[model samples]
Target chain A: MHDKLREHIEKIVPLSDDEFSFVCTHFSIKKFKKHQFLIQEGEVAKHAYFVVSGLLKLVYTDDTAKEHIVSFAMEDWWESDYYAYFTQTKATMSLECVENTQVLCLSYEDYKKLCDSLQKMERFFLEKANFGFVGAQRRIISWLTSNAKERYDQLLKQYPALIQRVPKSLLAAYLGVSRETLSRLAP
Target chain B: MHDKLREHIEKIVPLSDDEFSFVCTHFSIKKFKKHQFLIQEGEVAKHAYFVVSGLLKLVYTDDTAKEHIVSFAMEDWWESDYYAYFTQTKATMSLECVENTQVLCLSYEDYKKLCDSLQKMERFFLEKANFGFVGAQRRIISWLTSNAKERYDQLLKQYPALIQRVPKSLLAAYLGVSRETLSRLAP
Candidate 1:
């Protein structure tokens, strides 16, 4: 699991053995079954998770108790109720497992320590954050300019593997369409 | 204007005079009249702007020749065709001055140089990027769960000053509503 993380980081910044070892010390690993929650709304979000394996969904529940899919994290991706995690507040969003999962977790304290101890890790994280912001900005553009059908096609093209793995109902939620509507749009 | 930039950076990380001076060397200032385009579709986005004063709209024109408002940047805000700016490609959207605007421009090359020279700037940018991602996530959640009226109200609540400054037609575009519909909703 740690090797997976090391490889992800090394894609952006090469790390020496000593550096990688030091990086490992800040993270702890855990396993969860399908339907388990990594973050629960109204509780403090303690760690930001990096998925080593399996699938997870970040969701928000409305006043009517309807679920809205915020995003999905799979192999090699990171997921968190980041507002809560960064501000040390109660999570308004919840993260739950969609399949049996393994994740490497980094607590806030350790995240700072790692950045302070090694500048390269800070650079790596800065690169990740930059692209993360860009990704979100693109999503906002998609929402503003595309209709449901266009969005569905865009998602299908961008993450065909993700579409294959996620259930139709969940995919419908992520695309902000009724299952009937998504069914019409999808092959 | 430089002081505004320094104050914004100091909010997250305090810099020494020498450090701030080095940072100033990397940015240049420019002025734009209303209706001027800072970035145009199909042209390379050479700078990521830090707004010193006035308003700008980042717009995407769809194949149907309909203009959609991707976002608005005002005083103390940053705006760019970031995907293009980071990747060194032609812009897919255009940024136009909504009012006479003064901006501090940081070219991609200068941005990289500043990050390499100052660890504190990296930290400051990392913080900005993280919050920018979080803000976008919240917008996505709003799109998923809220109706137009709810979203309009949320926008008014969050940025009351912005509403007073922005024209209703543009706000309608941003909210994905027809101008008539927005007029009915706005006070």
Candidate 2:
């Protein structure tokens, strides 16, 4: 499990074995059954999880109580209510396990402590966070400028595996479109 | 001038006078006349500029040669073709001085050296880059979901000074709307 986690971290910032082991010591292995809530809105987000196996969905609900899918994370991906995690505020989003899964969870406090202890780990987190920000910005731009079909095409091009794992309705919500519209556009 | 820059850097990371001075040594001041190009499309973007005085416009031109304003930087702001700078690719966007400006420019090589020298400076740059990404994502989402008037109001709320300094046409381009429409909506 440590080796697998290290592989993901190495993609962002190469870490020595000792540095990786030190950072790994802070993570708690969590297992969730399908349809379980890892996080819920209105509570402070304490931890961010990296998927070791299975899938998770990040969602927000509207005033009408309709849930909108914001993002999905599979193996090697990280998920959390970042606003709440970063600001120590109540969460506006929720996280649910879409499949029975295992994750490596790290509390913000532990993560900060790990960063202070390991320079490579700190750089790794910083680089990953920056890259994630850039990706989010690009996704937002694509959503604003592209039509439904174009957006669907872009999603497929970027995350082909997600199409197989995520439901069409959830994918529609992620794309900011209706289920019927997405169905028509899907190949 | 160095004091002002030091204060700006301190917003993200506390830096001692010695550290600030060391960071400052990596930068060179450059002056630009109004409408001067700091960077142009097809050229490799080599430097990121921190505005000390005046304003700069970041824009992209389409195949038809029509320009779209991406962003404008004023005093205490930083501007660059970040995509090009991070990836070391030819710039697709251009940076032009909207007014006579003085800026502290840091080449990518010098910036990397500074990051290696000071861990705090590295974290500062990473955090700022992440903040920019988050801001850009929110801006795109707002553009997609909000009406023109709401967007204009939000833009003013975020950058009150831009309304007075930037031309309406450029603002319209940034908002992805026409100049006439923006003029009609302006209070």
Among incorrect, acceptable, medium and high, the docking class of model 2 is acceptable
What are the runs in model 1 whose C-alpha is more than 4 Å off?
none
Clashing pairs in 1: none
Cα lDDT for residue A24, model 1? 97
Lowest lDDT block of 10, candidate 2 chain B: B137-146
How high a TM-score does candidate 1 get? Answer: 0.98
Q: Candidate 1 at residue A77, lDDT?
A: 92
Instruction: Give the best candidate by lDDT.
Output: 1
Scoring each candidate complex against the real one, what DockQ results?
Answer: 0.86, 0.38
Q: After superposition, how far is residue A119 of candidate 1 from its true place, in Å?
A: 1.2
Model 2 Cα shift for residue A46 (angstroms): 1.6
Task: Give the TM-score, chain B only, in order for the candidates.
Answer: 0.99, 0.96
DockQ of 2: 0.38
Candidate 2: C-alpha lDDT: 0.82
